[model samples]
Target: MLPLIDGKVVDITGPGRTDRFGVTCTDLGASIIAPNGKLVSVFGDTFSGRRVGQGDWRSPVVLIGMGDANHEIVYEYAGGSDPAYARQLWDYIHDDAASGWRRGGISTVIPSDLLRVGGSLYLHAIVNHGFGDVIWTEIWRSDDSGVSWTHLGEQAKFPADLHDGFAQCWSWDFDPDDGWVYVVATGFQRDKGIILMRVRPDQIGQRSQYSSWGFTDGRWQWGQQATPITPPDEHWGELTLRRTAPGKWVLGGFLASSYALGYRVVSSPVANMYTTPVQTPIVGSSGSQVAQLYGGYLLPGSRFGVTGGVGVVVSQWRTDTGWPYRAMQFKAKLKDTSKTPRTPDPVNL
Candidate 1:
């Protein structure tokens, strides 16, 4: 785990607009280890414009983690402050009109989550028609560890309205016990509950191989009509589910109903979620220092097994100001018990 000091959530893109990472501002720093064994983080809605989300607007930019100071993330080729030299995984939809960020026209493809199977990295990204309205989601492959990519084609494409539009946003982790990829999906609009699905590792490219889990015939079984696994009236956004340790899983994200970011621990992918209460270590405030907090993707160094400090990247955006539209690293102190809150407010970091 990367050592975290103080409760301060430091910015990863240097000092923001003029940072040294060659990235001015970015959100959704979903970290994943690249095929080359280097730490990698994928960002959404990256802008190198003189202002936030303005100039050089690009969707889905990936960075190579150099260590955390270590807050530095460089481009795949090389990194610097110049936006023109910035390299992206693909040139699918890049617009730099400064005011041409129209949803339908620009085709803003936001990365939902990433997974590395064997020697390949698969990226699941959503194509947006407009805010909360997804056109479709596609799976892209990179055998050279993100240096290049190949669209897996219609065989791997998932409809935006799959599961009644609840399957647009995804978070997945491979389960070696059954050699299946366990995935939990919610609406990209942040307006729906969650459901579970599993696909054999080798059949990831075939949409037919993906089976939904549900409470059918009085037993939790796959291949049934997908049912909501979340509590009644609970809606989630931008969640991540990872096996932080052997047999131990951590799941949670932006809890839309409560307007806070929290996490819950479970023993297996099929664990009952209602009983495992949400622990909100970080709460969002309208104008607090950590204002407009949303993303709660677990960082690489998080240790959920023994109970200590867990590192995660949380994003903050000033909807009014546009800057501070970046992801920052934070460390939370937690004990083994899941009863309630802990230590003090600083531990709530």
Candidate 2:
């Protein structure tokens, strides 16, 4: 991984309409180490340096992955002119004569997290736009450090029939401890709400079928069955996991709703699969990236949590009493996750 100077703001322009898929900072004040033992740093590009939601143009989707300590992988998904963007990425990571890598579908594979397991590097991508409109969680692997790819296929069950809409899955992570991968997704069969599912690494590149929904509404509560954490209904995007203390893993992200947008936290038994999620106050939005610190640890002496990506704060519009918290600039006091309470106590003290 490249060592970016602390507090250094670099500009990378000229990538026609860039859509940043995710951002991750490695060094979390010594909690999580960078990919290769070096301190982790920030590496993300905006559309011509414009803020995330300000520009009218759609940016290129970028996903960051770690492959060993020396190399940081940045994967982009562009379904325009190139047509073979995914294939190009495959070629870049693998050698020739390779029959297409293992992937679920072909439209858009925007990876949420890139992980290395048992000498092979696997990518967790949210299949946004494909031949079918449905969205899905897809996995792609490279045994030789971004050399040749073996499209392991969709990380979830392959439907009997393909749908048109994107298979909008929230986010996913891998658990080395249990050897399983967990994902949170919404079934298009329904209008709204989310359904979470758990899969294994061996299930990659292969297809499975599910008769009914994978999760229930009460499943996201804290200290209940299925990992025992209650996730907020706010627009909580994808999830990323890391080991903070011994045998303890924390899930981080922003809970985005029509009323409020802020960071969230939950502890889990397995590494990436989140069964139950308890909401915390690390409130704020991180655009495409959630509340994950790249190195996979919280900040040193930092009571509050650290949020990545285009940090934007919106007021809570929907509450029990219908009180609205207007969107505001959170640049100054954003990192104060320590001050946040376990429940929805947005007193702003």
Candidate 3:
């Protein structure tokens, strides 16, 4: 049974989108397990395409909820400089000082991004903006659940450097093996496109010392400099990294054309390393991030006409800007073709 919150029972089968309340900002966080045997999802809300200045970026807060049903478990924000909005959502719609965290009024402020690592939570937020444009990547942890927060570093600590020196990190996932945290960023130096980076989960708020990877030169290279993965004319749908075989890894992301975006698979000696993304022949459209859970099972993603694996499911969607504002799901059977070629082009031609 799905959980309920605030006396409201959320029905997953019910239609999503409860009336466009201020354009549901894009959210990012980790796929995690909760204390109550439930999967926990953490994310932040921000504008779709516009920045904070274009309109008032109000009600700065970080949200936590049950992963399957979207039942909001906790809504966290700062008291003074970073305000919490759940205490007032419907009634205090646009009230600024009603919760705190707004300085130059609500119209000029935007909060930071949030990430979870090891067993703790971290946040990187924008403090003040202007000629120099200062920002901070602050750290916070909740040992007893999301009831209280302990602020860990200085405010506006690492200006314009953490998320590609100006780019904001939109999606992030962590690998407990090497303590490396990966973040997928959209805006860098203001206008650069999508890029990927690797950081130590322990380095949050320390310095912006993450490694950058590029899908260029017919391969991937590490640098402080990076090139966009999705080319100009083409659109990238979704990206996911999952462990399919024991010690065997898969890095998959989808692309959309007028016809279809098929299942493409690429293997690397290391989980995140890829010379170039090899496209497979299975044709479909609008792909999604894949999660490998419970002994070689694909947890979420779909390719029609594909079947036969126990405990597998997929999430498909129609997206605007290659970023899925809304997602639809499909139940699929994952097949093992390890003995066969992943691509028809042949392994090493």
Among all candidates shown, the one with the greatest TM-score: 1
Q: What is the lDDT of residue 129 in candidate 1?
A: 57
- Higher TM-score: candidate 1 or 2? 1
Candidate order (lDDT): 1, 3, 2
Q: What are the TM-scores, per candidate, against the unseen true structure?
A: 0.85, 0.45, 0.48
* Residue 347 C-alpha lDDT in model 3: 23
Model 1, residue pairs in steric clash: 22-80, 68-71
Question: Which scores higher on lDDT, 1 or 2?
Answer: 1
Better of 2 and 3 by TM-score: 3
For candidate 1, lDDT tens digit of each residue in 207-324?
8899998877666778998888888788999988877666677788788888877788777777777766777774322244477888888765565433236666778888888887
- The models' CA-based lDDT, in order, is 0.71, 0.32, 0.36
Cα deviation in Å at residue 252, candidate 1?
A: 1.1
The model with the greatest lDDT is: 1
Off by over 4 Å in 1: 1-6, 14-22, 68-84, 94-106, 283-289, 305-308, 335-349
List runs of model 3 lying over 4 Å from the truth.
1-31, 43-85, 88-102, 105-116, 123-140, 145-147, 155-166, 188-192, 214-220, 232-349
> Could you give the C-alpha RMSD of every candidate to the true structure, in order shown?
6.3, 12.2, 10.0
Per-residue lDDT tens digits for candidate 2, residues 1-349, read 3232112111111233122421111011111122333221111111222233223222122222322212222233322234223123432221112334334334333344445445665554444443324445555665644434466644343442322221343344556766665554433322333334555666555544311222245323322222212333433433334333334444443333432232333344322222233344333333422222121212211222433322222222222322221111122122332223345422221
